[model samples]
Target: MDNIISKLRNLDAYPKINEDFYSRTLSGGVITLSSSILMLLLFISELRLYLHAVTETKLVVDTSRGETLRINFDVTFPALPCSLLSLDAMDISGEQHLDVKHDIIKKRLDSHGNAIEARPDGIGAPKIEKPLQRHGGRLEHNETYCGSCFGAESADDDCCNSCEEVREAYRKKGWALSNPDLIDQCKREGFLQRIKDEDGEGCNIYGFLEVNKVAGNFHFAPGKSFQQSNVHVHDLLAFQKDSFNISHKINRLAFGEYFPGVVNPLDSVQWKQETPSATYQYFIKVVPTVYNSVSGYTIQSNQFSVTEHVRTAEVGRLQSLPAVFFFYDLSPIKVTFTEEHVSFLHFLTNVCAIVGGVFTVSGILDSFIYHGQKVIKKKMEIGKFS
Candidate 1:
């Protein structure tokens, strides 16, 4: 045991010197004090860095497939009435969400932009269990009456019991309900009166749509949309077409789940139509983002960038109707952010480097000052110094 101990001590790199042989000077003391202060400052800086988390970002190719993209939006049309406003979404996957009403809320705003009433997207009351009419002649109260679609029915025995069913039948036939006053279901449900009730009012629509993860567009336009000759069209005369205004303000628009420090470009965006009849379009590029927190939790989200364009309507041309369209496409590259703290071993290594570097530099400077003074004193004594 004694021999082993002696062998280990022989391997020691630092040899101690006696204090009695030490020669300390004022310059040496000053350098020691300055170097100590500098070393302390450096150590404090390193400690702060170790305590705080650092975010590391990297880009990788996105290879995800068959995923669903969720879009959340809160838009306010300051000059469009809720009765005439409609929401539609379509993707490249051949899926369509037209006149979307599920989980949607609409707020009626007066001319002053203040909310007057808030309700779900559907304007009318619930569909009555009993049918409203059957044919040109009124059926007795005890008869099992069946409503009519007024030539829009697909089959002879088809029945349109409610105003919504009547509209659906019209949409299927590629026919716009040009005159709601003539439809018995519409007249019974007071649909035309509802449109006149919200005259000169605005609308605030907020909703979420779950769509296929592909390039697609969702738009806010006036009137109900239908397909005519395989082309998407909206019945511009459903409401007051001549008085349509496309001025709108976007309160919040996000592509996916929320994450910390995420920035969405289109939040709180606003646009006003300068032309009498025009269209507002937003082209958006969505980037998928994955965030890994220091606590081992991960979040899947997305960030987006947008560009706006306006197309004015020609005097007699019908290239497009007044609407706000958001066309989004996904990016092939995905960004990942990782948050982590410095490792214990790494922190210790840096601390040692800082201390050793400062100490070695200070020793060299002290030696230069001491030896320089000694040489000058010897020259002055020999009278060689002028």
Candidate 2:
């Protein structure tokens, strides 16, 4: 044990000196005090860094399957009436949602942009009692009341009970309901009268859409949607021809749940119609993100980059209706964030290094100063220095 202890002492990088050879001076004392203060400051700074946390970010391929994406939207159409505006969504997966009205809220605003009424969307006026009597009063009480789709019916038993149902049937058959005033259900429901009442009003529509985690587009357009020869179209004849303002403002549009520091580029986006009719489009690329905080809190959200375009709609030249369309695609890679604190062992090692390094440097500086002063005093005594 004695031999081992001697060998360890010989290996020491900092050997001790005898007290008899020690020298003290005012300059040496000043240098020691200064170094001690500097080391103390450095230690405090390093300790603070070790106590706090650091974040590491990474990107990896996304392997999620069968997951759905939720899109939240708040849009204000300052010139389109709620009676004629509709929402449609379709995806590359062959899924389509037409005339979406569930889980939606609409605020009716007058020409002055003041809110006049707020109500749940898709609510039609009260159904007309005894609609058959209003038609002709020719049917018996025992007979089953079968209304007409006006040559647009798919079967003899098909019925159109409300004005909306008649229009829907006509849409399915690729025929426009050009004359709502002529249909008994429309006349009884006062469909034409409702349009006249909302002539100069606008609509604020807010809703959420759930879809597959894939590329897709959803739009807000005037008139109901239909497909003809593999092309999507809307019943433009149902809208007033005087003037249709396609200008719109998007209050909020988010892809998923809210997270800290999340920024969506499309929020508060507004577009004023420059042409008589035009289409506004947004193309977006979405990147999935996962954040893990130092306190073990986690957030799963998304980030996006976007580009926009506007196209003028030429009248009577065969074109799609003026609308706002959002098209988005997903990136294969995802980002992750992790938080961490410095290790105890690392902090201890750095503290020791700061103290030892400062002390050694100060000792060297003090020795040089003392030796130079002694040499100068000897030279002055010999009359070799002034």
Top lDDT model: 1
Per-prediction TM-score, please?
A: 0.83, 0.78
How close is each model in CA RMSD to the real structure? 4.0, 4.7
Residue 15 of model 1, lDDT score: 91
Best prediction by TM-score = 1
Error of 2 at 269 (Å): 1.6
Q: What's model 2's overall lDDT?
A: 0.85
Off by over 4 Å in 1: 1-38, 126-132, 358-386
- What local lDDT score does residue 131 receive in model 1, on the 0 to 100 scale? 42
Give the per-residue lDDT digits (tens) of candidate 1, residues 14-122: 9989999788999999999999999999999999999988899999999999889999999999888888899999988888888898889999999999999999887
lDDT per residue as tens, model 2, 236-283: 786546457889989999988887678988889888997777888999
Clashes of each: 0, 0
Q: Measured by TM-score, how close is model 1 to the native structure? A: 0.83
